[model samples]
Target: MAQEKEIHFTGYEKQISNWTDLIPAERFTLLVLQTLTEVSKDPRGTYITNDRLSNIIGLSPTRISSTITKLKKKGYITVQRVGATGRYIKTRDYNHATLYTYH
Candidate 1:
């Protein structure tokens, strides 16, 4: 059996720090939003669970839930609970014109 590689929290924290400078203040929520968008875009139609999203973004599951709530309130994303599966839908339209020109 192949051993799973462990991710260091320090490295994850550094990565998040790098993104803070790159992503705009208004678009700070893009990390989680973009991840959900990309995951749903996959051909296999893989739906990312809250736990998986938290691990990917280096956030606690509670934080992920809170972020999701905020996104839904702002009409940025939608979540659907279907039977046992939870699906996250990204509703933010990507405006390339105003994307990252500021920074």
Candidate 2:
């Protein structure tokens, strides 16, 4: 079996912990987004799709979309549309994925 990588968020833990209003699913979504951002090495933030998050986090795409909107409304995250002409994931177009960064 492959060993999982250990991730250290340094200061992010303290910041995220203070978001007590977040429910379990929201919190999990944030963690996953954080992980993706950390490993992506993209300063613009992580570009991800709801379907991908659904697959990883075991939530439906609709739920993932709702959670993201909630996070944005709560000032926990910011999103940017990087265009739809570049990149793709197998059968799906990459247009659905947006650049996400946590504040």
Q: Which consecutive 10 residues in model 2 have the weakest lDDT in total? A: 85-94
- Tens-digit lDDT string for candidate 2 (1-103): 9998646553355455556898879877887787676567667567788888899999999998899888778766677665772221111112343442235
- Single out the weakest 10-residue window by summed lDDT for candidate 1: 8-17
The 0-to-1 C-alpha lDDT of every candidate, in the order given, reads 0.54, 0.67
Q: What overall lDDT, based on C-alpha atoms, would model 1 receive against the true structure?
A: 0.54
Q: Give lDDT tens digits, candidate 1, residues 36-88.
A: 56556553333667788777777778877777676667555556655666674
> How many steric clashes between backbone atoms does each model show?
0, 0
For every model shown, what is its TM-score relative to the native structure?
A: 0.52, 0.66
Off by over 4 Å in 2: 1-11, 84-103
RMSD of each: 9.7, 10.3
Best by TM-score: 2
TM-score of 1: 0.52
